[model samples]
Target: MTEVLTKRKTLLEARDLHVQFASRGRKARAVDGVNLAVGEGEIVALVGESGCGKTTLARTLLGLERPTSGQVLYGGAGLDYGSRALKAYRREVQLVLQDPTGSLNPRHTVYEAVAEGPRIHGLANEEEIVRDALSRAGLRPPERFFLRYPHELSGGQRQRVVIAGALALAPRLLVADEPVASLDASVRGEILALLLRLREELGLSALVVTHDLGLAWNIADRVAVMYLGRIVESGPVEQVLTAPRHPYTQALLSVLPESPEPVVLTGEPPDPTRVPGGCRFHPRCQVLGVGRAAEVGVDGKCKGEPLAVLPAVPEPQVACHYAAATGS
Candidate 1:
């Protein structure tokens, strides 16, 4: 097993990040003015509904996709994207993609697939490095599994191989984007346990991106809730999950399918392109309560003023005009 490192600075940071894509002759902001950080050995979860840009933000962090503006800082310096920095960044921050089979090449055996990274980077000899990576990823007794192809392994094993490939680079931060989504529910728990144990053993920080609040509840130290390219709320795991301040956050938690129904924040979320003025959530917010905007400082039916990301009661930050009104 790889010995976990001790005493390291912030592993990754993304500040004022924006990601835009041209769609229908118009620029669509996938990630809009986001800021986040991951400590040396802490796990932060990016939670949101689908199409909220969580995946895009993760991709931006990994340099798989470039942000339109803002900066992603790693180890105190801006990610350069120059040859040296790119190479270093790729090694230090790796992504465990959602799809195991899709991410792995069918033609390559497990040994070839896992060894590819070290070979491309000229970091180590193939045979020794492949064995080490497979072992590290818990394909224990590595020699027995090295020659198998993606098709030969079960979904869980294939995913482990994918993780092995990423670990071959000895990354300090692992960006897991729904890494267990495709697995069966029982297997999902096992994978989560494996990931958590890996963090403890390797001292790795993780940015786990997922739309499932349940999954976030299982593994996250902190949760940042995003809605339509903006962070609606964020804080420690228990606080944010149990006492959500933003209506959107509340809505997300209410529909979790767990027993003991939470207070449901009514109304559908507003469309991204045509977001309402001031508080974006006011359109569907039950707390808006007919001409109560002025009380919360939202003027004229949520048109009163620009929205503010306010610090709510209990250590959480919620971006909602009525966070104080909600007794959050």
Candidate 2:
């Protein structure tokens, strides 16, 4: 198991951040008071199923989505997403979207695409910057691909071009939202390797959002498991993945091809807008499966605990009320 270094500076942080949207006349808190951080020279994966708000959290952390409440801090200072400041912050922290097809413009050549950020920032030596960025992104002899359009490249190549564009800006952090989810299995490793390589060579931090546990295992130093907009468990990759404390995390693992004692979740995840009282997961919780309004402890606390986001805890935070009993 790979272990993350203990002492590292935090590059970005989300302090109890919440991103809510009004959908179908009900409020949906896509990012429900998430508290997370990406340390310098470290890689963290936000792992969860679809609609768990991983992307929304990434957008908010990058200052692309305004939080309904709470704060996003860069180096411990609050972010001001005003046009000029946001633009400057953008140059320091870039984003790689999930879809290369939608992200890259068909009309733009690889050179043009890579050059756009430097041009927008009015940086000198656009040619050197574009070439170096592409080279760093593994398009060796970058000149060879300069004139090609998005359609002319393979899916992996197109994704690399997008990554190169981000690298052109010379960002310290990369918020990659499912960077390789669309590619063939063969190409996924290549892109993941590039990210780790960038971290080693350039001292870059990354917050990779994806549903693939294997991807997290492959690259991240830490893993944060999200369920219905809140992180239920977070810790070192090996600790979280190998010995998950949260019931949901256990449930997710049970279905894995190599999982030995998989815990199957009953019923679909609850609706975000209409989240249940007490524990949002109580309805589908295996701990409560014996019977609804089940009693636990002398006070029967499990029957009714207020439904609020879990507070910050020690490493490997688990939100389940019965995490201690169930995990053991």
Candidate 3:
């Protein structure tokens, strides 16, 4: 457990979570044996490429998708899937999607969009709630946006509106999926700052689902790197990002603009439906491909023995046979 998590209450947790989708005769394992947690008022980033199951894990945590096995827990209690229980759960954990333009209905005004959640939950003082949420989301003088449409706002403002909608319910956590992916670079910074500000001001906890390592470095207290339905490495942002042990994580960081030399893995990640055996990342691992595994006498294990699922803890952990054996 990181110092942050140890000091605060665990707001959400996933234990050995698995999500599978069956189509035709094959089952796609979207999330496989994952264990993760979010501390109260902490921000954790789920980092991975597309098809790596980060999004699926986020959906499962939000109660949008039921796990094939394992559990999603809130405040140490297993989630109840009953309608009333789920509805009540959602009020405390809200989702902010990638595209603000698509997230908001064109016909709905800003007030309606922000007020929608409080109204549905039958919360009193709808106007006050909406206005406060909008202001907190950085749309100063919230009344100015009440009658505006999505088309009328800048990209950043539109995203703020989407965030405001989530805020209206007084959610304790926000699961923002690629929250700044669609915005301009400058706008992206603004949105990231808004999230930090919200956390500082409201003690908000967030699970930010994104592929951008830079964004994780900017905002997350911890980061979990996922690949082919599993977390290959995870720990405090500084430890994982600065001294990454897993080859997959090293490759990701190497590609950053500040990296001296980029490490490029060959080919795309394997299909989730037919994940490679042993180390799922071995097929594209730079260390394995360069004979480091063989030099360490772990080549056979890398191809035949699967690593155990990584436990979400404070210290950095990497689930690579070569890394574990060689202490890389």
lDDT of each: 0.80, 0.85, 0.93
Local distance difference test, candidate 1: 0.80
Tens-place lDDT digits, model 3, residues 1-328: 4665678788999999999999578999999899999999999999998989999999999999999999999999999999999999999999999999999999999999999999999999999999899999999899999999999999999999999999999999999999999999989999999999999999999999999999999999999999999999998999899899999898888889999999989866668898988999888988888898899899999999999999867678899888889787
**What clash pairs does model 2 have?**
254-262
Better of 1 and 2 by lDDT: 2
- The better candidate by lDDT, 2 or 3, is 3
Candidate 1 vs 2: which has more TM-score: 2
Q: Give the higher-lDDT candidate: 1 or 3.
A: 3
| Model 1 lDDT-worst window of ten | 1-10
lDDT by residue (tens digit), candidate 1, 116-145: 889888985678878887887879899999
What's the lDDT for residue 165 in model 1? 94
Best by lDDT: 3
State each model's C-alpha RMSD to the native: 4.1, 2.4, 1.1
Ranking by TM-score: 3, 2, 1
